[model samples]
Target: MTNHTILEPLREDQWFIQSQELRSFLAKVSEISAHTVDDRTQTLARLEPYFQELLVQQEWLPQKFAQVNPESRMGGGIGQWLLYRAKNQSLSIFSLVIPPGSTTPVHDHLAWGLIGLYKGNQEETVYRRVDNGDAQGHAQLQITEVRRLKTGDIYRLLPPDGDIHAVKTTSQSASVSIHILGNDTGCIWRHQFMPESHSVKSFRSGYSNAPCEEEEEKEHALH
Candidate 1:
């Protein structure tokens, strides 16, 4: 099995600054509070434009980045690479490569998030956390819904909708996704996804897969 090389560079900042579409997204996002049930539906609506913009600007994302099967050793498992960050507020962009026959463990976000699919197809299983801890010390996690997303699609996950889900990539290639979240100078916590174990945990750690040490060091100094 040969490693599938990314022929194109992962372009960031192509869609960072505020645009007409981004402004519209922000409007919808402003309507929902992190503390309310409306946050789920509103956030998804707001995220659609960003995803659309990314697809329009970089059409090759979905066509070129397909999910690879781990068995074939052609593609790797789900991993993240942070693209950019700023003072006060930070932007984190990551690519989630899901190999065929491999799925992400169910998890939820500690902060607001937006996801867009660049290539292939994926099945998302949404879950809700139940507060009633069973006698076995395992918390009750419920599967609420399942959604199938294809290339050039986008969505949002928030705490209000109980945004815990498992993603399974379609066959033929690896499924790649671009995720964006706000990280306030490492003040915001990160939500970790555990697919096999079906759990998510929160942490206040710095970006693990940031672009480079020198760049990260500079950013840290400014913060």
Candidate 2:
């Protein structure tokens, strides 16, 4: 467990700083971010091998980093445990846990993202929007790559440096990943593609654990 004294500076978000292991990971992120900021190539080059190693060697996160109850039907469907977020929305770090047979919609992040698979198996498919509409419109898509990621695997999606894809949890056990995105991912609206309609719409992919007015009201009622 991490010393409680170290968590005071990062109290705005939900995090299990008690885990010394997770704290070490966060420390590594901070160190890498300082040198790699705004440079996708640098970020990938420096962080890629680091996360790749983490996927292979590290195991275990605090209980709080997981679903409240492991067998509780995965209450929120997909679990995204927010750890730390920058005030300027420049970056956001969180853990995403997907239950077996579940998948995120085909979506694109306007900003860059780095995904590290911490546990279980993941299958992701990357797509490119191909539209005959004017020079600016994207109407259809072409599958670029289908990656099979196992625990200890890492990949980046830097609009210009990489591709966009949706992830599916193929393991019987839940799959967990650590996501570091360029901006406030939950607050910003991004594009979600509909292959069947050959269309795309702007939507926000909010995490399940984000605080909101509705949740506050429920808490106030109970109080």
Model 2's number of clashes is 2
Show where candidate 1 strays beyond 4 Å. Answer: 1-47, 59-76, 132-137, 184-208, 211-223
Q: Which 10 successive residues of model 2 have the least lDDT summed? A: 1-10
Per-residue CA lDDT of model 1 for 46-129, tens digit only, reads 556655776555533333223332332112355443334433243445456787667765554554668888777898888777
Residue-wise C-alpha lDDT for candidate 2, range 169-197, written one tens digit per residue: 89998888888776766556566667777
Where model 2 places Cα greater than 4 Å from the true spot, the runs are 1-16, 56-60, 68-76, 132-138, 212-223
Positional deviation of 58 in candidate 2, in angstroms? Answer: 4.8
How does candidate 1 fare on TM-score? Answer: 0.59
What is the lDDT, from 0 to 100, of the residue 21 in candidate 2?
Answer: 57
Q: Model 2 residue 34 lDDT?
A: 79
